[model samples]
Every structure is written in structure tokens, then in C-alpha cells.
Target chain A: EPEVTQTPSHQVTQMGQEVILRCVPISNHLYFYWYRQILGQKVEFLVSFYNNEISEKSEIFDDQFSVERPDGSNFTLKIRSTKLEDSAMYFCASSVKGAITEAFFGQGTRLTVV
Target chain B: AQTVTQSQPEMSVQEAETVTLSCTYDTSESNYYLFWYKQPPSRQMILVIRQEAYKQQNATENRFSVNFQKAAKSFSLKISDSQLGDTAMYFCAFMKVMNYGGSQGNLIFGKGTKLSVKP
Candidate 1:
């Protein structure tokens, strides 16, 4: 079974620093998404990407966050300046079709900001 | 707006026993999808099962099954013959069907239920 893969299973960055979390979605998937989960909280949708552009984003996805499908398979999330509250697990997911199809998730990248 | 709610924060079941996790959602759209995902200590999200709102017949995968009540807006997951490996945090998620030129389909997930299948 093909699965989404994320890099740097764990990352620790200082406050005000920049960090880039990367993901490689399944080859055939066209829709990609980024989600965040604070410790002990529900997972929240950050943004969705399709056709190499952002399709939708949540309120939490503010100016500090940006996503890019830099290449054919690589999808990345970049934080301009990390804040302490930004510490959480970031998940990458992809699906063949939008809501009707199952979205496969990656193992997640745990970001810890100090 | 769409929301998914998992009332149970934690649950435990003896090995080989049956366990059910509750989930309820609020959505005006008649067409949607619901899913159950498992996250073990490894922190990997695994899709356990999924149910389509338009389909009255519930979905089942091996020992994992769902009891979906469209009228009540309820979708519950039932794990039969639960094994120790079944211990994990279970999340219920909701997604509204996408319409052409509408917002991208994004999932709204509930606070997960931490399930422990003890030996």
C-alpha cells in the first residue's frame, strides 16, 4: 500500500526561527492537505492544495504559514517565524478525489518550539 | 460549518471483548462522509473504516464495523474481538461532499477517544 511520507520525524526549533516541514504524497493523489494537532487537542485543518495552488485555508492558517507543491511529489509547509504555541504535530494527507475518497495520512512531523 | 464530536475521552476493554466508540456530527449537507482513524503510540494515523452518508448500509472491515444512523447524525465504531494491538487513540472525522467551484474538501476531526485493550 502506498503511503504519504514526511521528513524529520521530530524537529526542535528556537522561537523566531524558521522551519520547513516536508511531505511526499502518493504519486497518483491530486489533493494534498496540511493539518495540525496540539497536544491533547483535536486535529485542525490548516490548508488544502490542488492544481498546484491553495484551494482553501482555515482561520488558523494565518500569514505565518505557507504551503507549496514545489515539485511533482513534494509538498511542504513553511513557518516564517516559529512561536512557542506553534509546537504541535503536523500531518500531511493526500487523496485521489476530494471528499469522496479516503485521504491517506503520513506518520506526522512533531515540531517543538522553544 | 461542520463539526464532529466524540463524547468518550477514554475507554478500556478486555482482550477478546467487544468495544464501541461513540461519534456524532453536525452537518446540513445531505452528502458527506464519516471515518474512523486509529493512532497508536507510534503516532501514525491509520484509517480503520469509513461510511458514506447516502448509503444506508453500514460499512464493515473484518472485525471493525460502523453503526451509522443518518437520521440521528450518529456514527459509531465497533471493534469486535479486540486485541491488545487495538489499543490506540481513535478519531472520528467528518467531511462534506465537494461541489464544483466550492471549497476544497477538508476534514473536521473530533477530539479522539483513547482506547486501551488490556490483556
Candidate 2:
């Protein structure tokens, strides 16, 4: 019953500022993913990482967003320049096996850009 | 592009009554998987149920059950004897059958239905 854990449950930042949300995925899970959910909107996929590299990313993950597994246990999403639209709940998910398997999500990081 | 559709934006049911959340997905892939997740006020996404497209039988987990009609592209979740805790935003998701990228399954989520189960 291990779960993915994210830090800074809520964060507020100004426009043009840089922000990094951290996550510690389930220890034994191999695949990691980042998703964003704007207020009253559907959850949107941002990126997925495996084998220490990005396997897939969406258009929303343009130049502003990047993900890295800096260490064995941590997965981080860095936003180079925050925009008003970037405010949302960022969820980190991990699966024992990629897309076909059930992915468990973290409590989520609420990022608010002013 | 694949789309997961949840036509109901809001639904209400009295405690102990049954409620069903409808979902329909558009996917060309013959093999795939469907999932239903619940996000309560805490905003944490919790898995509710899952169904494999290839399976003819519906998948049920305790009070949670799914009516998966592969031909109709429908996967609905039913909460039997709904409880107050069942009030939340429920989302329907789609996952590809093949995960060449490995254990990380990319999911396509629906707009979500805000369900209110009153006591």
C-alpha cells in the first residue's frame, strides 16, 4: 500500500519565477508520470519518465516544463518561468509497469501563480 | 486523438441509495484498459475501479462495480448503497493496451463528474 508522496502541498509564486515540485514515488515502482489539473478541469498528462529519461511529453510541457529523476528515489518537475495559467494541482504517479498497469497518484502539489 | 467523455457534470444521490456515473471513450485501439478515479475535497486522485477491454465480464470491487460495454465504447461505474464519503469528482480514464515505454502508463482523463451523495 505504498504511495507516491509530493512536497509543498501548496505553493504561491509570482509570474516569471521558477518553481520546482518534488515527488518521491513508490519505492518499488519503475515508471513515473506528472499530470496537471487546472481548477474545474480534467487532469492533463504532462510527462512520463523511465530509465532515467523522458519517454513522453505533451504540448503543455513546452520549453517551460522539464522533469528529472535527479536521484534514485526522487522525481522533480521544474518550471522555468511560471505563467498565470500554470496554477493547478500537480500530481505525481507511479506504476509497477508502464501504461497497461494501474498507476497510483500522490496527494498533489497545488501551484498557484500570481 | 483519444477522448474520454463524461456527460454528467453533476449528480446527486441520497445516502444508502445507488448511483451510477456514466462514461464513454473513443479509441481505435483494439486492446486497451479503462479506469475510474475519485478526487475528493482533499484533491487526491484515488483509484476506484478498472476494466480490461478484452474481458467480457464486468469488473466489480465490493461496493464499486463497472458496466463495461466494449462495443458501445462505454465504461460506467456504479456505487452500490452510496455513502457520504462517495461525494467527490469522479473521472473516467483510458490507457493504451501497449506500454512500450515500460511500467509508466500514460492516462487520458475525462472532464470529471461532481457527484454529491447527501446524508
Candidate 2 lDDT over B1-119, as tens digits, reads 88999999999999999999999999898888899999999888999988988889999999999999998999999999999999999999998766453334779999999999998
Taking the true A–B contacts (Cα pairs closer than 8 Å), what share appears in each candidate? Answer: 0.68, 0.79
lDDT (tens digit, per residue) of candidate 2 on A1-114: 698999999999999999999999999988999999998899999999988999888889999999988889999999999999999999999888775677889999999999
After superposition, candidate 2 runs with Cα above 4 Å error: B99-104
Q: Chain B alone: TM-score in each candidate?
A: 0.96, 0.95
Candidate 2: clashing pairs of residues: A97-B103, A98-B102, A98-B103, A98-B104, A99-B105
CA RMSD, predictions in order = 1.4, 1.4
Which window of 10 residues has the lowest lDDT sum in candidate 2 chain A? Answer: A95-104
Candidate lDDT (C-alpha), each: 0.93, 0.91
Instruction: Locate the minimum summed-lDDT window of 10 residues in model 1 chain B.
Output: B96-105
